[model samples]
Target: MANSLHDTYLTGLKNAHALEAQAIQLLSRQLERIENYPDHAMMIRTHLAESEAQQKRLEAILERHGTSHSMLKDFMTSLSGNLAALAHAPMQDEILKNTFANYAFEHFEIAAYRSLIALAEEAGDSQAIPLLRESLAEEEKTAEMIGAVIEKTTLEYARREAAGQTAGI
Candidate 1:
């Protein structure tokens, strides 16, 4: 049972690492394409830094466990992240779509971190709990930030569209 818990904790760490990588890639792509929404771009930039820190924290924990994150997992997840950003690029409602996606992704990260924290506790890794909690807090904060702007962003997009201006960021 101890070995199984440890293995599961390691797997959770690896997955969280990959998820952070994907988030960084996604934010970078979106940041590049954003032209109209300075506030949204700024939000993404902030979360990007947080994601980088989260990834590093995960790495430190993994290294302490005598393992490293899976390069293949990171690469594949990053590819998907890039593809997801690209998918919204051509839409007239690109900004709206990206906003929705970002909000959903933040919640997903929050859930992942919560599960990782539980696993760390079960595995008797007290050291990892704080790091996981920090990541979890960041995710929760980001989700709240996104939630706060959803209505304003959607309305802004609508206004721009009604004015026949370029609305997709």
Candidate 2:
């Protein structure tokens, strides 16, 4: 993930395509979670909407090079759907499985966007650089907001669970 675009400009473009293919899966999972989990729907609405747009953006990036419409896209989308469905599972984990999933996913997305942006800049793809940068901005904001939510809810959930256990005891 060092993103060394040293050799050819096409190397950078290929890297970006790979990132898009990856993102398409991640976003699909998030979207499905938004649809299935009524509890998180409102809270994650903004991010979901942005993610929808992000799907389009990523696809456009791939389509720019005619690489978006590939088998990789379908595979990634299926994988992401499976993963996203798990987001709404019972609050089994101490931190809330969904919250952990969201955080881990956002972090992954942030890295993907960062890589794409760096490669876009390095390759001198002026159009792509701005588009990638814009997506990166949204990804950053989404990650920051999700991080805040996780921080706020984590301790509260832990304390409540602890209190419930004590009462039961």
Candidate 3:
């Protein structure tokens, strides 16, 4: 049972690592397209840095366990992230669409991290607990930040659209 739990913890760590890779791709793509929303861009930039750090932390945890992240998983997830961002690129309401998608993405990460934390606790991984919790807190904070601006973002886009301006960043 203990061995099974340890395996599960490692799998969770790998999934979290891949998730961070996807996040980096998504945030970088969004940052490049954000011309009208400096505030939103700044927020993405901040979280991008945090996501990179979180990836490194996950790598360290995996290393301590005598393994590393799945290269295939990382590659596939990153590709999907890029594709998801591309899907939003051509929309007239790109900013609004991205805002909604990002909020959902943040919540997804929050749920994943919470599950990872639980796995870590069950696996008796005291060392990994702190790192997992740190990532979890960051996810929660980012989610809250995104949630706070949803209405304002929608309104900004509407105002721009109504004024005959390019509002989709």
TM-score on alpha carbons, each prediction: 0.99, 0.66, 0.98
Cα deviation at 111, candidate 3, in Å, is 0.8
> Which pairs of residues collide in model 2?
none
Better of 2 and 3 by lDDT: 3
29-130: candidate 1 lDDT, tens digit per residue: 999999999999999999999999999999999999999999999999999999999999999999999999999999999999999999998888999999
Global lDDT scores for all candidate models? 0.95, 0.58, 0.93
Model 2: what TM-score?
0.66
- Better lDDT candidate (1, 2): 1
Q: Which segments of candidate 3 are over 4 A away from where they belong?
A: none
Q: Give stretches of model 1 more than 4 Å off.
A: none
Best by lDDT: 1
The regions of model 2 sitting more than 4 angstroms off are 1-40, 87-91, 159-169
User: In candidate 3, residue 18 scores what lDDT?
Assistant: 96
**How do the residues 64-143 of candidate 3 rate in per-residue lDDT, one tens digit apiece?**
99999999999999998999899999999999889999999999999998998899888888898899899889999999
Residue 30 shift from truth in candidate 1, angstroms: 0.2
Residue 61 CA error for candidate 3 (Å)?
Answer: 0.5
